[model samples]
Target: MSILKLKPSCKDYLWGGSRLIKEYGKEYEGEVLAETWELSCHPDGPSVIRNGAYAGKTLPEYISGEGRQVLGTHCRRFRDFPILTKFIDARDNLSIQVHPDNRYALKNEGQYGKTEMWYVMDAGKDAFLYYGFQREITKEEFAQRIREDTLLEVLNAVPVQKGDVLFIESGTIHAIGKDILIAEIQQNSNVTYRVYDYGRVGKDGKKRDLHIEKALAVTNRIPIVRKNSSYPHAADCDYFTVDKLNLDGRVMQKLSGKVSEESFASILILDGEGTISDEREELAYHKGDSFFLSAGSGTYTIEGSCDALVTTIREKAAQVRIGIDIGGADTRIGLVDVHQKLIAWKTVRTNAMRPAKEVIQEIGQTALSLLEEQGIAMEQCVGAGIGVPGTVDRKNGVVRYSNNIKWEDVDIAKEMGACLPIPIYIANDADCAALGEAAAGAGRGCEDVILFTLGTGVGGGVILDGSIYEGSGISGSELGHMVIVENGEPCTCGRRGCLEAYVSVPALIREALAAAGKELTPEEIFAAAKEDPVVKEVVDTYIRRLGTGIVNAVNIFRPRLVILGGRISEQGDVLIKPLEEQLRQGCFGGEKSGIPEIRTAVLGSHAGMIGAASLI
Candidate 1:
């Protein structure tokens, strides 16, 4: 395919200026041209393909027809189209607003959260915009200021000029001042929580409604340290990376770049006119032109006497993170790319008899072997996330002790780092599973969730605000040890009637066998319950005990959801259906508070591996 030129969709927002139409040559008959979506696949305003056999189709249609692989491997990380580009001409000050990060946005808005960067094209003298807070304020103080119409007093307003760059992370409070034209690159989400709209009435003659509560919940109420961010790129974020390209039509007549299969190239013309061509074909380019060159389109040459922003998703290998789940019996290692896809993996036995040094050495060697087998270079890896079954001193990347693997005071990160030149981060294995579930599995969009791994022993992780919250900065969240009964059955941790004693797979198996006067695996126990009354009682009691623990967790954390993982959870609806009933009846607030959505984890054993890889 040749270079795909895009015809932008126009927006006539209330705060729009006509600069886009008059100065930028955007053809729109409306009285005000607020923004031009030069590169977008959003249903609200998709860019139309302007040239080629698919000229009449919208960008989404083209992607649908050409297949998603045309977007390249890096884009696969996103659930939908990864980017949206726009030219905004702010005639009036935008509302003081904030945006939710990915977890919050996906749950509430059904889209990715917006993290945007702005490259100033033009700005009138004395123009200024709010960046964040001038100083940290209490939640009560913030609320009081907003209610008193004094919120702007605490906001940090900075003057702007042409060529200034500002990266607006999703939760940062910001507003664009009047008389400024900007080129914006952002995630595809369009959720904006307007905090303070300057009491301006819209064209409909009504004050814009304020999402003060949601804004307060998501806003970062601290002063942001401003920087130009010269990090070897124009802008860099989890979602996108951008570079500035300029040509004078004088000394530099042509610029060249290679479009590898790992990522496609998106070029937006800011000024001047020139032609962009490759091995496939050549196309004319001018200001306002947006071009999409498919990945692996090799040896692209831009004979452009123009200024442009060249954006591309970094290659998949470059972002691949390794997740290593160290189990007593066997260890699972997975290579997850930028999109959290486990593209390559390996399984090796845990040589528990070996010294800690040798075990760590093997883990590192196996990782390199997997990379070699998959044809990935070490330079392509971001780093590794290791999930060990133990208490860890995360501050120093030390494994204080692991009962499962019988290791103590091991600097696993250093051992692995020696074998592999990349950074090695270690965390509790159960925590890794929770993070994996939250990142890409059943818990993907939820912000706060509890993952119960119902394995040999019921270990789990607590994810709050997209992070593992370890209380007191060291030891806490030993969810399995929470006692549900007094002086009942002894637990592996020497506690009587703890949640793990009643709910873990081993405990269930022992009790089921004793009840039925016969042996059975968890799978067989569930199978026997259907026809045997004794086994049926065992299943019922197991569900009730597990429900007790779920109720306790829900009431304490009030998380949006709960995920059941590890071995016993794979029984599917057989175990979950009854547990849900128990939770419905046991939760404190009844129907008003609503029980969290409880679901079996989809990632299974790989959760530890994938979660570990994503820690970076």
Candidate 2:
């Protein structure tokens, strides 16, 4: 089946204080404003009705009767469907604003608060966006400024490129400047409290009411400036994470892993063009394209020649510390600790997969000392797990083949066990991720789970009945090798139409370069996806294919839960909704009731390490 399609409705201005004609050109003049295009709610948008005899009816109307039977209470608001889509055109700058948390919004606005990202469509040179205030301003100080019309003095104005993307958390004070168009994907709510505006008149020639009291109540005093370059810095927060991608040359970048349960990714291609390949399909993207890749145990790859931007979302932590030991070209080990709950150690060398004995020896000498200091004896340590970038025989603990690590048929677990006098586990990095989730993170407490990781190459892992499911000598669960399209694209696995052929990180980056007509990174592609529809189309196709693969997994396993991990998972709902929709449309079963609960993986990079530890 084809990907699920959402119908969008437009909103018209000329009412109350909302400006319409002036903000948008005559094409939107006297016409309805395009508020949202998805099947969810905006109060001003359209809804998706169930297909059948009542196909054209509103979702609400259909749900009131026969539709209720086909789609049960499992999805009262909407089954496997995303909640909303928002569109904004800044004629003049919007008032600096902020949204409250869900509880606060329900109490005050009788709706959900918005947590959203902006994908710039059209921007003038030197365009700007309001992210946070300049400094910590006391409520009294903000109140006085609001009364005197001097709020802009306290706000930070960051210049924007045409394809820039910025994440606006619930309490962030922000606004869009004039001559900019944005497609805003957010939670299903419209409870923005306007703190300040440029004193502009509406189409009705009346001043808009300022929500000074509410704005001051929710505004975060910390100042923030959206970075202007392709690769802007990232600031982790409890709600979400925002980062910029600037791709140059044929580069494949991996996100620095974090320890967090439930993360998502939003890839917005700011410029250039190329295709993002994953385990299942290939996504051709250009500018203004946004696609969501679920982060699980699977690794995905992207490739192209144009520049792009990518953003990842994951759990926030109090502190994240990393220990790096650069070992020339032999092997470099990186150790990461997050709030003491998670730890990840990685070894990279000029070769693809190191000899099992060599890896065991290095891990023992380097990481074991640190583990002992942490009260874990070499024997008390659960298991030592290793991830090679290439193929693996997880069941037999054999490194099948790794072009990067340069190893084949090496018994990793056996060799490690001999060295440490403890149980040792080994799998492809992606499979290790599946074990990680099952042992500690998102898939914890669930008997059956599936994980997909998005990176240079798509990787996958499955857990069934409380244990990692390695099929037929551990050759199974190679989800990245699955083919979603016939004769689609070439993959590193030496196969065409494989999932990695379309949705891998390298593939996504490549698509961004092609769109911009220059080389860039995944972060740059994300920025471009905000403003360029061509990029958006590429992302949309990628997202749809990703969803299709997920649906296929769901149909085959029908697991109780599905957790998305890795960097691509940072896209969050941008990828989740469409994928969920596809699953719903494809899955056939009894009662049309509760299927699998699909969520972002809670464990971030630590999943593999912890899972490996669990093996002890």
lDDT for each of the candidates?
0.85, 0.58
Question: By TM-score, who's the top model here?
Answer: 1
Residue-level lDDT tens digits of model 1 in 1-616: 7479888999988899898787678879997988999999989999998888898899899888987788777665544677899999999999999999764564466555688999888899989888999999989998999999999999999999988889999889999999898999998878999988878998899998999988888888888998856678888766678999988989988999988887778899888898998877889887878898877777889885988898888744356778899999899988998788999888999978889899888888788778878987544666788988879987678999888889999998888876664567888989889989998999998879899989889888889998886887655488898999989799988779899999998898999979988888999999999999999999999989888998898899888889999889999888788878888898889779978889999998889998887677
Residue 51 alpha-carbon offset, candidate 1, angstroms: 0.6
List CA RMSD, all candidates: 20.5, 27.1
RMSD (CA, Å), candidate 2 to true, equals 27.1
lDDT of 1: 0.85
Q: Could you estimate the TM-score for every candidate?
A: 0.56, 0.43
User: Once superposed on the true structure, which residue ranges of model 2 sit more than 4 Å away at CA?
Assistant: 1-356, 394-396, 590-593
lDDT accuracy of residue 461 in candidate 2: 80
Tens-place lDDT per residue, model 2, 74-133, is 122211222344456565566667888554564466445667777775677878987788
